[model samples]
Target chain A: MALDIPSPAALQLTASPAAVSAALTTTQVRVTSSFRGARIVLYGAVFDPSTTPSDVVVIVRGPDLPVRIARKTKVAGVWVNSRPVVFRGAPGFYMTASTRPLADIAGFGTLRRLGAGIDHLAINAPLEQHTETRYGVRDVVVSRLGADYLDWRRAVVRLKENAGLYDADDKGVTFVDKDLFKAEIDLPTEAPTGRYQAEIILFQDGQPVSRKVRSLTVEKAGIERTLYLFAHRSPWLYGLVSMALALGAGWAASLAFRRN
Target chain B: MDLYLPIAEVSVNAPLLVALGALVGFISGLFGIGGGFLMTPVLVLMGIPPAVAVASMANHVAASSTSSVISYTRKRAVDFRMGGVLAAGGVAGAIVGVEVFRWLRLMGQADLVVALSYLVFLGVIGGLMLVESLQSILRRRSGQPPKPRKDRRPPWLYSLPLKMRFPRSRLYISVIPPVLLGVFVGVLSAVMGVGGGFVLVPAMVYILRMPAGVVVGTSLFQIIITTSLTGVLQAGRNQTVDIVLATLLLVGGVLGAQLGAKASSRFRAEELRALLALIVLLVGLRMGLGLFFTPDEPFILMTGMG
Candidate 1:
């Protein structure tokens, strides 16, 4: 057993598996009328036996969408939304889980580069300008308003976390053995319907060795899907249908109660 | 059990929603008010988006009002001519009101304005009703004749042109007053996210001098048209109406309204008014305190903005 321990150089020299093979408890999250939330289990086995001095980090990113946050200020004895910050390309849901604490596993720069944390997400401010030159101007503005923009960005993260749409857990993943590990992601009821990407990164000595990406679909099913489609596709008809239903219900209720 | 609201994009407890509807419907039936003001705030508190809350309340009000209107009509209490005139003006006022609402929203002061307005209106109305009802109750208990309210129309109302006769109300008043009154209620309904029945009932009793028997049915008729218009416009413009939510509320609301109507006959008029006044005061005070109290979170987020 002592002789089986390879030297550090030999360990580095050996060819590792290109990527980890992973499977999800369920690939598709079907949002039925009674859906509250779901706990998805992701299990994977590191192919290389020599991948001991490594960590596994799983990142689940939901679809990107624009989000707006407003800060309330006391004005004339009342609270009102005064400053609004709009964020573009913000994920509707985001979660990161790691076998060990993210800070202990990797440096800030590495985590940022990998976009493995909520703070490291690539979100942009929607600076209103149409012209191509606006990018340069916006960059200058952002630099000048760096502190304010950072506060707004942090607020966005805080809001999403509060809403259960963004989360991170250092101990969310556990290694069953040297070769197998599992991560659990809890999807909240507010999870938007869209394509989600689950990325599993294998890290060796705070460096990425291999990575695997899996596509997951979160979709409204059954009547939920039909109603959503009807509202979005033909809003006028949807409105009329809603009105007719309301009227019919009212009439029926009146008739039913008349006898009593 | 939990049910998902498609437009609101939130899952809520089904029984809780139904109970909320029942409570508000009972209040509406007892008071002859649409209960939108109460319902909207409650929905917002339940984590539903404000826009969705307001739009769906309109749908619920339309249904509830329709049911009440049918009952009132069967009893020959509705003055159709008066309702028609008010509804016509309401339509035009609602158009103008929508524009005003948009303008206020652009300035980001809509929420403040709505809250302040509700506080003021509810406070004043509730206070007045409380005092009058209490006095009436005391007078009746003491075996004294209740003082009669002055029924004389204002001079300005008499001088106005386009006079019309409301045979059921037994009034020959200027149509302009009712139309203008309708416009005022319409604007309030649009801006306040209510059916304006609380305001309408008082206005009809005092300003238009409509008989108490005719007020509930007539106001309900107007509410049906006005709130239905609001529901359609909200759906068309904002796409905020959640039919699933509205349906749940309507189911509970219709049944609750019937039961409340039955219960109303059992209570004395003054006692009913006093109870309603207490509820209004409580709601108003809660809203007023919200304005002064520091919020747990000074920052709020509005998602899905493009």
Candidate 2:
């Protein structure tokens, strides 16, 4: 589905300088049993069309979750997991779309400050303080593993990327007219269920002038929701019910076979 | 028909799951086993998370064994007195197993432990079964009867305290051995997600010296209790039980088991044992190869625990 901001709204916004607003085609994604994937369009308007052209950056981040990353090493000629590190508040889903390459749009410092790209994404651990001085991009995440911390951080991004949970597009945003702009993001089947924030930023002169945040939710629906809730909210009851269903099914099958 | 499983949090082909369940069920019914040993590995291969595969298959095994126990009871082949003692020990073992499973998961070693257990148990059991069955088959071909297994209880077994008489099996022995056997099988069922039939059957025959006729029946009866408890514990503790997945599997399993039981009458017992042993060995070999092979991805990610 294509999202379109009304032209009248853009015209009204044009009266006020440096104003931007965006909305997703659908704010709530219902993940039923048959759900495969979904494509959502983020459309918005730029207020000052007559002014110098500005770049648009869109970032969609899913709910933060605690994750553990484990690396395997060969031991006794067999591959086994050796060291595991846990990172808290890591986004389960993260995607970035921009009018131009993030590096070309702004300097590394500015991009890092804005958190505009995958490399600049913030991932933190709770223990062992350390500073990353790689290529003059100083970011600090606490870790006791010394230099291995960077490897773990990169591993998170690499693993998430392989799972289709992290993505970035250099030229994902496009302008349809002088003031109308849109970006399309594909939410894969592996997307986690939670609230996702879509941030739309208008960058002018290599600086973010105005930003708007739109949020969407991905949630289980129908039988999927019922079962998920049943399993989590009341696990003991769910277990009993599971046993009852299995026993009943077994008893019925036995009776049927016996009668024949 | 791809369907999303809520608990496993993955989409799997519905028909594929049913067919897998049917295949395991057929084998179980033919052999009078629980089939969990076969089912869990296949599910893991299908990309269902290992923990979910183990727990949900326990549920499936419980159902399948329940059906088999009924027929065994009707045949008057079950030793309820022994089964009860074994089940008591099994319950205790299952409780401990679940805790260990959770601990292993937290340490990110549960999958490795599961695979290694399968390889070791399947390799030893399958190899032994194959050798014994092949020898019997060879003996029958030469127009000779199979050698009678020594049914004498060990000297140490007689001196143990808390002895009890099992009238059905016609044995008076210490309850310690049976309880210990039950605990070992119970731990196996919880950790490896098996009905523990393959292991239990051999131990009963060789160690407990149970009659061959009652061995299968009593094993099924014990499995029904142990696995049901394991399923409940896994669901309550780990929240890994997928009802939808289990139901689909049960539907195909119940139907397949009935057909397999009917077909079992046509095959020679020795031939069946040889076939089952080969299948078990093959599964073990595959599991072992996984440990040796270099994985495409050496890094793993787990969520929910910090």
Give the winner by DockQ.
2
> Model 1, A1-260: lDDT tens per residue?
01111123322322565457788899999998988989999999887655367788998889887786677878787777865566776888899999888889988987776777887787767563233336456434333235566777787888889999999999988999877899998999999888888888878778776777788999999999999889888877887889888878888888998876
Q: lDDT (CA) for every model shown?
A: 0.82, 0.86
In the range A184-236, model 2's lDDT, one tens digit per residue, is: 98988789888888888787777666778888999999999999999999998
How would the docking of model 1 be graded? Answer: medium
Off by over 4 Å in 1: A1-18, A128-146, B102-108
| TM-score: model 1 vs. ground truth | 0.92
lDDT of 2 at B129: 97
Error of 2 at B84 (Å): 1.0
Instruction: Report RMSD (Å) for each prediction in the order shown.
Output: 5.7, 4.6
A-chain TM-score, model 2: 0.84
lDDT of 2 by residue, B129-246 (tens): 9999999999999999789767667888889999999999988999999999999999999999999999998899888888889999899999999999999999999999999999
- Can you tell me which runs of candidate 2 are displaced by over 4 Å? A1-19, A128-142, A176-179
